[model samples]
Target: MEAVSYSGLRKNLKHYLQQVNDDATTLLVTNRDNDDTAVVMSKRDYDSMTETLRIMSNPTLIDKIRRGKTQIAKGKTKQHELIEPDD
Candidate 1:
């Protein structure tokens, strides 16, 4: 993550956008008024984070994931088809 003042963001919008696009680095914009802050990131990173947050927000799904991980670690997983295809 990189921090830059709002004024700096306006002054160098192109350079900052390019860096964010090319390196997937998050940019934090700070402002003196009302202690406001904003974030800039690539669409891919933003989508991935949103999806992760969505998953984490579901208690049942999270528990299932944890249980699956533990089962894999314990070699308790069985080979099975996750989906069925019909002719």
Candidate 2:
């Protein structure tokens, strides 16, 4: 993690981005008006985070997770429930 003022980021945006890509570094920008701002990885990280959120949002997955908990409570299933295909 690194801290830089807003002006510093604006002045050396390219350099900061280089650091981000090369080292997976984070820059925290601070200002009097805005407490903190972040500059992070590019679309790769954005797409990955988006996909993760999508998968987590699936209702079927949510149901399976809840059912898994129930099965565990009742000692009715092992590590893998292997929920068969609905079809």
Candidate 3:
């Protein structure tokens, strides 16, 4: 995460935006008043976060994931060969 003042962000908006996108990082923009503070992040990161949140909100899916993990820990998993598609 990187922090920059409002004026500083405005001065180097392009640079800061590029850094955030390339690094997949969040940027904290601070203003004179705390109420105006904001966070900037790449769209990809934002979408991934939302997807994770959505999955976490489902109880059944979480239970299934936990069961799968438990099975792996118990060495009850099976390995399957990958299937290739015909051209």
Instruction: Find the candidate with the highest lDDT and give its number.
Output: 3
lDDT of 3 at 43: 95
Ranking by lDDT: 3, 1, 2
Query: lDDT (CA) for every model shown?
Result: 0.94, 0.79, 0.97
What is the per-residue lDDT of model 3 for residues 21-68, given as tens digits with 9 covering 90 to 100?
Answer: 999999999999999999999999999999999999999999999999
Give the TM-score comparing model 3 with the true structure, all chains together.
0.90
Q: Across residues 46-76, which tens digit of lDDT does each residue of candidate 1 receive?
A: 9999999999999999999999999999999
Q: Could you tell me the lDDT of residue 6 within candidate 1?
A: 95
Per candidate, the number of residue pairs that clash is 0, 0, 0
Q: Each model's TM-score, in the order given?
A: 0.74, 0.56, 0.90
Tell me, what's the RMSD of every candidate? 3.4, 6.6, 1.2
Could you give candidate 2's per-residue lDDT for residues 1-87 as a string of tens digits? 788888988999899888877776667777766746655675666687888798789989888888989998998964656889998
